[model samples]
Target: MSTFTLDELVRVLRESAGEEEGVDLEGDILDVPFDDLGYDSLALLNTVIGIQQAVGVTLPDDIVSQELTPRLLLDLVNGHIARPAAGKA
Candidate 1:
């Protein structure tokens, strides 16, 4: 299982926000909400899919409903990595 890093979360979130060229996110972004970062539920779902692929974990689609924030994402991914599923999604 691959433990997620804050930096990785930033990059994935930035990409998930639809920055095709990608943005160099820095500083305190963990505290920022996904909506503030320009993402809605649909976009956040996309981001969650990206996280699933990147981290090789089976994540529930409703995770975005829990709150689409960097901090929440980081914590969730860490939890998944710490306890990976027997079968991946």
Candidate 2:
């Protein structure tokens, strides 16, 4: 899998946060909290879906309950991307 850079991940988060147009995607997403991202649980679920769509990997459910931060999310994505394909054993 291709590595997803921090900037690209931040841009995706910003877009998911509904700030996609001209806003600076580099800004901190944790400026307030996940709620302010204008996303309800369903939207967040869809955001995870977006992540899957963009990166071709599924995020663990616990990641959200743990209060995903920008940095942590990037780390999680990086980890997923770095892992070998399933059933390669």
Instruction: Specify the poorest-scoring 10-residue window by lDDT in model 1.
Output: 16-25
- Quote the lDDT for 6 in model 2: 64
The sequence of per-residue lDDT tens digits that candidate 2 reaches over residues 1-89 is 67877677655655564553444545666443455544556555666667777888867655564365556666777777787353132
* Each prediction's RMSD to truth: 3.7, 4.3
Compared with the true structure, what per-residue lDDT tens digits does model 1 show for residues 1-89?
55799878767766766642333357566767777666788888888888887887888876776346788888877887887762354
Number of the predicted model whose lDDT against the real structure is largest: 1
TM-score of candidate 2 on Cα atoms, chains taken together: 0.61
Clashing pairs in 1: none
- Candidate 1 lDDT at 9 equals 73
Q: Model 1 segments beyond 4 Å from truth?
A: 20-24, 86-89
TM-score leader: 1
**Given candidate 2, what's the lDDT at residue 8?**
73
